[model samples]
Target: MAENYYQTLGVDRHASAEEIKKSYRKLARKYHPDVSKEADAEEKMQAINVAYDTLNNPEKKAEYDQMLDNPQGFAGFGQGAQGQGGFDGAHFYRQSTGGGEHADFSGFEDLFGRFGAGFGGSGSRRQQQSFQGEDQHAKIEVDLDVAYTGTTQQITLQIPTYNAHGEPEIQRKTLQVKIPKGMKEGQQIRLSGQGQAGINGGKAGDLYIEIQYKEDKRLYVEGADVYTTIDVSPWEAALGGQVEVNTPAGRLQINLPANAKNGQQLRLKGKGIPNSKEAGNLYLIINIVLPTAQNDQQKQAYQQLAQAFNAYNPRA
Candidate 1:
């Protein structure tokens, strides 16, 4: 019996794409051949890869879901599979044809070729199943600037697929992918006919990639909004002043409000995640920095400021 990809990845059949990816990552790290001490680490890694390949693609997953939904296909007599003793065709073919030797079914072409090479008379495995290949999926991490400004990038992926003999193999592919501006995290960009190869003479499938942003030191994202920390001096927070701030969108001179407290967020509307409609906002979080009293003059200044605020209890 074929392995259930969901079980292989330790994910539920209805697991979301994100959940599937998370599980795959965990299992991959555990079974990584170089780091793992287990004897079956390499084999487990291979299975994880194959499972992720199937579950990551929407089309392929749907096909697999359909198969799983129909348990009769995996068990006894399904549709025309009925026999005197519920005999399986592939089993019978292998037995009667001398353990996979070619059998010429010239007149029974329609009968044998209906189920691909598993029951076909004599043809290359690829020539038997004339259907479009399963679509493939991959994820990419780019800098925040890449989301602001569109760019093209080269990407490589190990595409899992079946070859002419109906055996699984890895097809390494490198492609130049175009990234459009305003591409949000977890959004997908599609490339046509770049997935697994088509069976027989059928049309090939497409390749889709989920675009993500690499973590930035200062910037963080929530929904469409972007947030970044801005450092301001004690004076800048205490008194309204013009402060130069650097943001992912650009640099700007912001007017700091009087008595702006620490962790105060100043919103610059429509300045983040640019798009034609409903653009996101950029939020500047204020972080007040204290000046060091390094010398007598600075210490005296701090003393003076403390005296001026003697009536104010900061702890209060």
Candidate 2:
């Protein structure tokens, strides 16, 4: 039986494009074989990639949807698939017939031809070499401040140039990329015609850059919102006062209201890292800190104040 693509990716059929992509990226990073140590990591990664590719791409998603919705063309209803010994031959044949979607099958041809060279067909041998050179991959780390403010970066990528035998030899190149404001981690930026050179005059592939955030101690990002914990003295929490807070844009004065409690949040609108048109907000979490001790003079003053207000007992 064909695996349920939506279920494999843990997304609903009505999921938005952004949600689907976000889920896929998270799963892909977790299961990627190069970084993951699980025994089944590679298989899981491949399955995730396949399922994502099917559902995220509109054409493939439509095809799958149609097949499921109109299984009457074959010998099964939707539920009939499980009870009737899995997918029947008629269903398999219909799926293989492209389901009336015209996709370029040349990639499959090359894949098969390369593995079936023993057949000794001259056509197959040519097809085997028709695949473009391997696509190059690189990850770029950017500062969180830059992600909000948007900045261009000059990055160096070592692209592999292949010899006639397809062995990779690294060639270095520098590219200036405009990182859009409000860029998020795991988001991808593509440079057209910047990937591997195509085979036999075919168009060059594309360069894909995935975004990664450098660790920042002061800020935590969740989607568009930025969070930071601010330390406030007990008096500041008890009596509202204006305090200067640091943001990626710079320091700004924020008001801490009287009676503010720990974990209280103050929102600064349009102060987050700037994207293109609008900016996200910054959330300041209040952390109340108490002074442990004071000098002799300060302690004497505190003792006098305590005697004046002896009726107060916080514990009681």
Candidate 3:
């Protein structure tokens, strides 16, 4: 009998995407080969993965549902439909992509499940007309500095496939990617011919990778602009002078205006993300740091300073 994906994930056939993911994650925590002490954890994990791969994808899930609805509906559509080998539409779809040796899922990790805005793929799989393979999308996160300096990253994606013996399996495909400098958040990098294979010699679809910056306590990004906080001594805020500070690109000194107020902002032009077209600006937020007096001399100085501004009621 064909495996029931809904039963495999312990979900109702009508489970929503979130519900399915939640259930899959719950199972993953339990039967994940690395953590589970169950003797058959490996087999159970493979079965779990196979089930999730089908149910998580809307297109595959729909076809799988249809196959369940009508067991003999796809018999004439493909050679391995049901019965003979318990195959279904999804199985043929996997074959259409390409066959490969099963890869290890040692560190399988997928945060933003691969889906797309529907670029193009797997269309018109009729007998006469060829169809392009489906395009794939994945999101990756990098440090804020990568936008300034650029970097190379290797990513592994789980691809569903069938083995030579005609059993469903997941394949791990890793690729080295070059992240160009000045790339902004939500930007996409296209890898040609890296998606599923086309039917009847049609051109293969492309893989689009979206870029995301990891969160940083000191820095924040807004489009091409960058913002950061810099602490200034009380005197520096009151009596403007040049001070050196750090930045994503490097450190530099900036002149502060006399009587500069706390929480004031200074813009350093062309200091933000360096995209190929235009560079962004960097803004520094000033925070006044006060010094506490412990010695008599320091106390006397503070008293004198207070006397100089005796009539100045800050609140008033």
Candidate 4:
């Protein structure tokens, strides 16, 4: 008896057509003889292909279901459907025609053609069809400055390609990719037709480049917005004044609010990453820095200032 078709594909007997197709695609990628390194990969792939072919077709699936329901009646059916020998739909057709030598196989040709196209044929070679190349994914690191202002970057990738002998080989591909400004972390940049080469003259696949930022202690990125700490002298924080600060875009003089407290965040609109879309905002977090007295005059000034604010309790 043949292996249970559902069990062969690791699907339920009532698995939907879409579910069956998904399982087949996943298993095909895993156990394909050209890719798989397992000793029994070829045999396992043949079984997977046969299982998918039988269950994928409505008519064949119905026939298979009936056989499963009454195994005794179809005892002679699917004798070599398990391992090396694939499911024999042709033999089943022959048996249905009372084992006659003139049994017609033309009706089954189309059925087998679809299955044979997917998995390399067993008996006769079938006409090969064009297949789109698989898509590729990679990561590219850019500085915060590059993210703020769009720049072109040259990236090299080791792409999989098939040689004349149909053996898989890695080829180095260098691409000059333009990264748009305001591109956030985890954002993808697509390169058309730069992925794996197609099979039999089919269209090549796309390459997706995920953006990552290099570690910078001075800047923190959040989407299009950027944050940075601005160190302000204690006097600058206490008294309202204009101060010059360095930003990713450029240097700008910003007014410090009167009695500006530590950790206060000030937003500079349209001062973040510049892009065609809405520009990001830059946030400046305040950090008050106290100056240490280096001489008696400075110490006396600090003592007088401390005495002036003696009544104020920060912890309270």
Question: lDDT by residue for model 1 over 85-188, one digit each (tens)?
Answer: 33333432233334244653221343334433333235546223255667889999998877778899998899987665445689999999999988889999
What is the TM-score of candidate 3? Answer: 0.53
lDDT of 2 by residue, 207-313 (tens): 88998888877678877778888888877888898988677657889888999999998898987766666777889988888776568887887788689779989
lDDT of each: 0.72, 0.67, 0.72, 0.75
Report lDDT (Cα) of residue 149, candidate 3. 92
On lDDT, the stronger of 2 and 3 is: 3
The candidate that wins on lDDT is 4
TM-score of each: 0.62, 0.54, 0.53, 0.69
Index of the highest-TM-score prediction: 4
In order of TM-score, best first, we have 4, 1, 2, 3
lDDT of 4 by residue, 1-316 (tens): 5557788788898789988975675565556555566677767876776677668878778877876686566655445443233335556555444537776554355444654544445666544444456678999888878877789999898887654333568979999999987788899999999887765566878999999988778679887788988899988998969999987777889999989999999999988877677888999999898889999999999999989999988899
**Backbone clash pairs in model 2 (N, Cα, C under 3 Å; residues 3+ apart or in different chains), count:** 4
RMSD of 2: 11.8
Cα deviation of 167, candidate 4, in Å: 5.8
What candidate 4 gets wrong by more than 4 Å, as runs, is: 1-88, 91-108, 111-126, 158-172, 274-277, 295-297
* Steric clash pairs (candidate 4): none
* Candidate with the larger lDDT of 1 and 3: 1
Off by over 4 Å in 2: 1-131, 159-161, 276-278, 291-294, 301-316
